[model samples]
Target chain A: MARTRLTPEREHELYTAVLDLLGEVGYEALTMDAVAARTRSSKATLYRQWGSKAELVVRALRNDKPVHLAEIDTGTLRGDFLAVLGRSDDCRMEKNSALLRGLSHAVHDNPDLFQALRELLIEPEMTGLQLLLERAVERGEVRPDNPALSYVPHMMIGAFAARELIDERPVDRAFLLDYAESVVFPALGV
Target chain B: MARTRLTPEREHELYTAVLDLLGEVGYEALTMDAVAARTRSSKATLYRQWGSKAELVVRALRNDKPVHLAEIDTGTLRGDFLAVLGRSDDCRMEKNSALLRGLSHAVHDNPDLFQALRELLIEPEMTGLQLLLERAVERGEVRPDNPALSYVPHMMIGAFAARELIDERPVDRAFLLDYAESVVFPALGV
Candidate 1:
């Protein structure tokens, strides 16, 4: 479907509104009417531009991502992982983590949101991570037959999900870097 | 405050209804009226017995736990980990995992719910895990100062949260056992 275009600044304003609303009310309670009201746009305009709430939210989240993991090539797995952490400061990471927790239920319930997340968000990151692992394997930093190789994404994502639950702490660059050195690197046999 | 008591069988019926409603409508959408309607009880009864939705839901979840980690001691950390997985079959595990995913947002949003979960569910489990780790430390399986020791809960819970997100697969006994052997055990140098 063809889409109407908003000016870059206007689009940024709208996406920011969507994220702020999402943070406040959560995905289950978020509505197109609210988005329209928040952005001072008509619901018709939102639907015309983004097609659905799922698409709009997913797109906003996609836009909010500061770095695409696929673009980072630090020539070493450890450096690549650290670079990903370095892209976001502690406060942003905490907010993003909260945002993700808020969306976890929505992702489980909404197939369209899950599809959009996989397509636009998860897939790109997974691909980038895979590249890093592949490079590690080629460098003999890790073995090809290591079963943990398949679980790299799980391990990384788990660090985010389990931090607050287990330790009552927000995941930060320092914690994650320490995790990478102690948990991930050792698991990979590096 | 003194609590109204229901018979064990009737209490089970009420908790089952609560969990069923929770699974169907989610925590945000779930209401005491719906719980009362489902269980054929008055809303007053639910309130009197559980005090609040968060307490009721947390209690129901606590009741639903098949294994208390503190009770499991198979002589090895690996055995203890596998035993926790063994308590729930694949289907139940998947259901519990989905229930957790459904509660993820609610846990973040509701302080009462989070508090109840930490007290009733998470604290018990963490204590049990700590016992197992302490045993390992005593056995000299893991070094006392290992930083990864602090992250064991993160890694295990991450395995649960990341399974569907990363691989589009449900977390199961086999997968968790493999994760224990590959990712977790290796990280601890066991």
Candidate 2:
């Protein structure tokens, strides 16, 4: 079905509406009618633009993530990680935590959504981090064979999940700093 | 509601039924009626015993996890981790993964269920891991104040999650061995 493209501003509005709804009711309960009512877009428009709820949510997740890595070169791998971790303020982190919690189940249920999420969000972020790690290895700040390179992103994800599930602690600047110095740097053998 | 207590064997049957149903239908779609039908237990009996579907599922998760850490003391932390990681073969790991996938969404939605899951399953396992780490520190295999102490459980959880979400890899004996040697040991500076 041919569909009219939304203007960038209109698309942003739809994405915001979907993400907010997702956080509120979760993916299972989120509906096109609700999105239409919230964003004042017609149901036909939404269905035409994005074929299904999964597609809409996937695009919203992609849009929510920062398109590129925050350009970071702090002269060392630890410095770069600290810098990147510090970039997300408490408010953003909280929002992300809630959004992620709401979407966690849906990601597992919908393989296509999960695949898209990894490709769009996880892969890009990992690639950027990989580049940052390579730079550190080049400068001899970290070993070329450090296995932490592969698992750092996973650990960071786990750290976020842990904070949410285990402690319900704030993944704020102070905590990330502690994690970087204590868990991350030592893991890197730095 | 004062409920009739089943014998240990019957309770085990119910828990198995709940977990199996959870794997088949997921938390959202799972119903008490389905569990009753599957196990051929009356709905009244189920409700009387567990109070709710959430409680039933929580008990199932608790029952599925190993109650002890397999009594591992391999003289070194690395060897101990390998022993613990190698304890579960493909089958148990597969069941745990499926059960976790089924509950991931519901855990965030239901606080009481989440609390029970942590207290019953996650905490016991972490306490056991903590003991293992302390033993390593006594043997001088790892530093007493390694930051990885606080984060190892989270990392282990992350490793499971990353395997599920990022790579879609099997969290098998080999993968855990690699993760322990690469990510876990180095993080501990062992």
Candidate 3:
């Protein structure tokens, strides 16, 4: 029998279910059977669509992102960063943080998932951030020779990863905004 | 049977074995049985000593750190930072980073593990770092009101967490020294 094609809406629903399950049980414990039950879809269809659990989870995470960094341009680096933070509300950011935390362990153990994350999630975000930095340089806001330029992604990502571990606080817009004003912007000497 | 006490050397051997197993199988797949067999100890003794796998893993990780930041003081913050980096060679840093990445995910799902990590590993590190920063402030090297002071640990830790994720690089002394000079020092205006 030919596999039924899913509508875009149906795909979104499936992804949402996957993310919900991922958040609840984590990547290690999340199962295709559970995902199928949650989404009311057959396990075969999911496997057919995503190839494996790693692919499916990565795709679901990729789809969950509402804004692409490439699409953000506010003429100033600070403005652009603020715009990026504004893309997700506090609740959504918290949920995404939990999801990412859940996947962090899985990525280390599973090479396929790490590859998928790099290709689908990390690469796009890096490209978008690079574009933003280039534009800032073109605008003479950031020095092209700044040593800190290469470390920007690391700094931003570290902020997200270390927040809960360091301060026992969630990564919220206020913290990010403050980080930008104090730590990041000064490092860039902007 | 009364639990036989392990000598300090034997305890060190056991912790080393636990860390090895953790690196091999990760936190979720790691079993007390595997640890006991690997260390030539009984499961009952393992349980009695550590109370649980979470506690055992956390203790092993804590024991792995050779340096405490509080003991690092070179009169200059930059010198102090460099001294801290010098504590771990590249190979040890790489192993530690891998262990940390593996544990990052486990900490999220297991509250008991998280609590153990906080009480044993994180709190001491944070306190040591705080002492360093306070000394810097006292020396007038950093302004007392600098907002960046509080975020120093976040930035340093973020660099460690983000290195592999962003650049596929290990957190080494060279990278950290460069990071301290370019990103961290400048942010503090020192």
Comparing 1 with 2 on lDDT, the higher-scoring candidate is 1
Q: Supply DockQ values for each candidate.
A: 0.65, 0.59, 0.66
- Per-model clash counts, in order, read 1, 0, 1
Best by lDDT: 3
Question: Runs in model 1 with CA error above 4 Å?
Answer: A1-50, A108-110, B1-14, B17-21, B24-49
Best by TM-score: 3
Compared with the true structure, what per-residue lDDT tens digits does model 1 show for residues B1-190? 5666799999988888899999998999999999998888999888888889999998898888888989998888888887887788998778877887778667766889988888888998889889889999899989998878988888887788788777778988888889989999999989
lDDT of 3 by residue, A61-111 (tens): 888887889999998998898888778799988898888876776776789
The local lDDT score (0 to 100) that residue A83 gets in candidate 3 is 83
lDDT of candidate model 1 versus the reference: 0.86
Ranking by TM-score: 3, 1, 2
Model 1, A1-190: lDDT tens digits are 5666899999999999999999999999999999999889999999889989988998899888878888888888888887888887989778887887667667766989988888878888888888878988998889999989988888888788777767678999898899999899999998
* Candidate 1 TM-score restricted to chain A: 0.91
Alpha carbon lDDT of each predicted model: 0.86, 0.78, 0.88
Worst 10 residues of 3 chain B by lDDT: B100-109
Kindly list the per-residue Cα lDDT of model 3 for residues B1-190, writing each as its tens digit. 8767889899999999999999898898999999999999999999999999999998888788878887898998989887877777999889988887777777757889988988988898889999999999999999999889888877888788788778788888888989988899999989
The DockQ assigned to candidate 2 is 0.59
